[model samples]
Target: MAIYSSTSPKFFLSSASTSTTSTTAMSTTKKLKRYLELDSSLEDEIPSKKKQQLPRRTCLVCDVEKGTNQFPNHKKVSSHEHDHNVCDPCYRSHLENEIDSKGWNEVACPECSITLTYKEVKNMTTAENFAKYEQACIRATLAADPDFRYCLSTTCKSGQLHPGGTDEPIFRCEHCGHKHCIVCEANWHQDQTCEEFQAVRRRLHAENERSQQEVKKLSKPCPGCRVPIQKNRGCDHMRCSRCRHEFCWVCSADHGLIFREGNHRHEKNCIHYRANPRAQEPELPRHRIERMLEPDTRLRAYNRGDLDDSDFDGSDSDDSDLDDTEPWDDEADLPLVYEPDLILSEVRRRAPGQTLSRVYVG
Candidate 1:
């Protein structure tokens, strides 16, 4: 009645198109539901099947084809329009070998031979090895520098040196808290010039040699104790103060020789018995005795404004007017507290060009 024809071409075409569209929509909804269910249960199941399908990577060092998991600690190098990768173990081995053989300056990549940056090398090395590398670098730098000096204090032998070209002769060792002369390389000789100090040092050395020779000539060993003794003015019969064993000074024999008779006589085997009776020499003059006993007084006089330019040339006419007192000995009473901040500030004030970038305290 309403022109409904079963064989109509328009109606057949519209029905076919609608059926195709509905079927496709239903297929898409079912596929979406399946995907949601799979995703929801993914945590409970082993995902190795999916991971196995992932792309495999080739290690540049070992030339082995491995999954991404094997290169967990890989290092990347990008330079000169090229990219490179090294596995962790291989990178560490290469860095360590380079450091042991050629130091940090020659640390390089095994494949490309290009020098590795500090950050790349540091990441591969251990903490201890990194510290050693830093120290080696510093030592190399110091070795190259001619003006560098080491602190002479035995306790704290720091490698810090004061900047040169300053008028100040005295420089305090920041590590040991000891003051030293930069020119003479000794304890600070504040009062005397470097030349005067050197002259005094030479004279002292000569006097020491002469005194040793005099001791060898004048002194003999005790027979009982082996302690050296010089007979000033007494009989040849000697008693050792250390061992209290009496013996002859000339022949170094037992005291029985003198005990046999009240008179002092040398034994027959004594070296000086026949020609000389081995009597002790006369006592030294009072002035000579004083000079030998108190050599420190004359030695200290140079620092006390007592010794003048004339005394340096063997003229000892003027006596020291200053009292015999050692100022440096009082340093022993001072407290030894290490204040790093104070030392750093003081060093900065004294040497503006020097910079203390790193400090290690144990």
Candidate 2:
């Protein structure tokens, strides 16, 4: 501090300025040289335009070959190495299946935002399983899918896409343990490992297993007919295919009692049996029907035109003005009786009070 006082402030300032200028020049020179070296390195790495473009690997899913530049990276399992030409759909499907079987609900493509199941990932065939990372790069032009545009997130349920990236876009659902992709709103990416997510996946696996068991239980065919069995109610009554004898589906034993009307149970010991009630003979309806005959019913004399207008009206109640027309003589030769029993009768075997009746005219 005392040394600065011995020197003129202007002189010191000038000297310091000169030193600063030199340092700036040196720094600038160094930066320029560094930039030149980087440029040279970059040029060396890239091939000339005249160089032939490498052929793209074929995608395994869609079976389309794409350029190498389109691929993101390749992959390998253990010591074995193989080309991953699989398309995005096939890969996503494979991953998804694997994840699901392990109980993972959602799996995102490591490269793309596509969602997949755990089963899809692990069950990949030997060919798909052995793809090299570079060859399997999902970014490859072959990975494009035009049909699928929606995000794969199970929780999002939002079907549309946004123009801009997500705000607070990259979020992990603490409840579901799913990672949401900003662009697609699809869940699959992971910024960090989550124990909660794994637990959720395991729970899903258990639930799936339970579902499969339930399906198996419901899929049993009827022992009697070899047809699919369905439980109408909790009773064990069942019938046969060709015979349809009332017996328990679990044990082929006769139902204890004869069938009554309106009982739902078909158990072996069930009181509900009637030689295959569905095979019962159809019955006709019953009602008494009688025909009445009037002596002058259709005679033309009954016609109002046969009488004078005064006779037809109340002003002329005299029957003397009426015309006496003879009935057709051919009627004498016609049979006096019409068809008999127009009203059908049906007896009730189940309930005596439930006899059905039908009325008819001929």
Off by over 4 Å in 2: 1-55, 67-75, 78-84, 98-303, 307-362
Strongest candidate by lDDT: 1
* TM-score to native of every candidate shown: 0.33, 0.23
Give candidate 2's total backbone clashes.
45
TM-score for candidate 1: 0.33
lDDT of each: 0.64, 0.46
User: How does model 2 score by TM-score?
Assistant: 0.23
Best by TM-score: 1
Ten contiguous residues minimizing lDDT sum, candidate 2: 285-294
Clash number by candidate, in order: 0, 45
